[model samples]
Target chain A: MWKEWPLVAFTIAGQMAVGFFLVAGFPLFLLDGSHAVGTTREEGLAVLAVVLGLLVAAALLSFFHIHHPLRARSSLVNIRTSWLSREIFFELVFIALVAVEIVLVWGVSAASGLSRGVHVAAALAGILFLLSMIRLYMLETLPLWNQAYTPLSFALTALSLGAIAAGFIWGGIFILLSLAFVAAEIVISFLLAPGHGVYRSRPTPSLRPPADVPRYLHPARLASSLAGLSLLGAALIWGRGRAVEGLNGKEWLVAAFALVLAGQLTGRFLFYGLLARPGR
Target chain B: MVTQYGFFFDAAACSGCKACQMACKDRNDLEPGVLWRRVYEVAGGGWEKKGEVWVPSVVAYNVSMACNHCEKPVCGLSCPTKAIWKREDGIVFVDTDACIGCRYCEWACPYTALRFDARTNTVSKCDFCFEAIDAGGAPACVASCPRRALDFGDLAELRKKYGDVRQIFPLPDPSQTEPALVIKPHRDAARAAERAAEVANWEEV
Candidate 1:
């Protein structure tokens, strides 16, 4: 049980960081009206600061998941064959790149070429980070995780949340796009679940502990299903009078976020718990 | 000194033709339902009624992705049996003979770039067409990209040519793992933020 805790902690921390970043960061990057709340500089910095903080926390937490955290440097040796090594390398680079971007944003305005370069670098770094994360699962060879959409869904979740965060910050037409992407992500993740046809692959012995047979639903799985439903419902009511009239839209977004967080947590739980030990 | 070989995807010119996907299949002799590379069309942002015209600007970005052959790969780190390893030139490859089919690497990776060949019960991905590269040729996918959207060379050279433009959107939550591919998005950073806000509002509703 203790052995699994590292995985559990890592999963929870990673999911929380991702959730917060998506909900908070997207508005700063994609919203236009956000400038009205505060100066563009202030709002952007707020978003960047949150993103940086969450990333750092997630990185540190990832170490706990490793059996030998001290030898973490050695993991980078196989950049050619392993996605984990690349994931770590890219994450370190992202830290440095985001730092540089923050500096550029402060030293130079949003319009400056330096800031732009940093943004691009950050974006590229983000791609690497996401790919590495997905590859980590792909390398597992678990039938449930070996789907084509695994990585796509992982990346899409981040993109969706980030877009939503940006909508909050900018408060322009971006809100609609962010909502749409969230809806799409809802559909994608649900489809990626184990029972789905796309994810169907060879089966292995049940990893569930013996004797705890209450239909064993993974927490992440339950959360994901709930999140999907809530997000879809939010989409349906988004353009309605209630949404346009008051804080109804904001309330729905909060609810959707809760569901998303639950789903992410569930995913993390399943990620560590459902290991397919060879010859089991 | 470490040298890594990988592919650069130009989303603007991708055209979504999927020639690279086909070329990869033919060259690698992959079985059906298995793809080394996939092209995804990403559309985002919303429409609003402006003064005279309904200004609806949506960003449609196409991503042609495969294994990034990262500088630090998660697959290798998680493999209990040293089945996956990095080539000297920075290409990651799995030795079928050594792989125990544990699937640890698949779980470690964030990109899902690696696939398990059920026939062999092992994993595989783009080898950078190591055979062709050794014979003074490019990977089949790069060679087949008619739009000139894909290129291969020293990582430094490609970065120089691209000039690392700003506002290129990275995969979400990059802090989780480091990936190597770079991008240059045409959209403005401020604009992206606005879109995010809108989504947040919608979700709240």
Candidate 2:
């Protein structure tokens, strides 16, 4: 299970990139409308560049998960039926769209108007990429990952981390959004807590009883998440208290991002741990 | 019409010697950690009190298994590169030439049929000894069984010869892949779940 670190990095990094991009781009979509390059355009382009960098890193990390990285081009061969194929396809599409958006918005003056449409398309692609990632693990054979927890957890990872990353940039308002995502995460955690280790129902005939999801990992994930939640709460209070000369709340948001990202890393590890090695 | 190939297992007769498993390893020249076939030792129950004294109430049996070359073949369906494919005679083959070595099929298969070959950096599994079958011979594992515990043939023929007992204790549900296999379950299997039986041999397989 620990050998799956590459995959862990790939999924988490990709999700965080998407989350950051979506959350940061929200202000642009809401605050601007005209074809003219707004004051925040440079900052927005810089943020998009960061998102692209994260995606490229994710794509590179994923190559290490497979043995023959050179043969990765063929991975999309079965897109008609395979979720794995669809996932790679969507991720590439998201990356390409983001890169194109950056180039068109900054380099080509004539193509400036197409930037919003491209951002929207890229966000949609990011969502599809995440959905495909979820679907890839929803194997009925593996009851541990097939549960509703997979999709819900993945989506929340994007929202929570994205909101926090956005808060790091957009500052004041996004802290509230981050808080909402974290709250939703806590609610879902509570909902899934009851069936943490037990496989009460047999979805299909399993060769052996479904191995229990690690009891130890859950507490660690919960602790980190709750700790991050507390920090975000503090950050909110700190922002309000330190609201002097145009405070964007970058001070506390960075720490919250680290804590939440660490929590997500632990959770992703636990997710892969569900497929215990030397499987029964 | 596609002639789906399959396997038949006689849990009652297996002695847990692991000859079939060894035979497969020898024939395929599998890597150190790779196994094409395996013998599972199912054990459960502890000392139970009788009228006067404690008696050993262990329900133990051995099951030798290989890929069943299923009808649905989830491994192939989930393969990103479409490297794993089924033949006309229902034999599933992994086209290593095309495989990207992602190993997603490894998780997709419930029977744990596929194993990663570190040497090839690709997934490998039992192919029903298609070459030997073409030359009018049995699979290495089936032929190597000392007690005639394993059998192989067309799925329909195997079902007709043996009863349609596809599921047994510690074997996955047949509906998942509709595995082309039949079995003669050990007597203790019916009570395995109630007796809290489990596949005890993890290190070997």
What TM-score goes with each of the models?
A: 0.49, 0.92
**Residue clash pairs of candidate 2:** A205-B173
lDDT of 1 by residue, B1-205 (tens): 3386656777667777889889999999988766677665444576877888898766555556677787777666676556678888888888776665545565455555776677776676667788998888898889999998888776666677775432233233233345456554534323443353221111110
Q: Per-residue lDDT of A87-177 in model 1, one digit per residue for the tens?
A: 7777778778767767876776765666666666775776677677776666333445666656666665575555445544443344555
DockQ of 1: 0.03
- Model-by-model lDDT, in order? 0.58, 0.81
True contacts kept of 1: 0.05
List, residue by residue over A35-134, the lDDT tens digit for candidate 2. 2222266766777878899899999999899999999999999999899999999999999998888887777641265887887899899999999999
Q: How far is candidate 1 from the true structure (C-alpha RMSD, Å)?
A: 20.3
Q: What is the DockQ of each candidate?
A: 0.03, 0.56
Q: Write model 2 residue lDDT over B1-205, tens digit each, in one string.
A: 4399889999999999999999999998887778889898988888889999999878899888888898999999999999999999999999998898888988888888888887788889999988998888999999999999999988888888998998898888788789888999999888777778877877778
- Best candidate, lDDT: 2
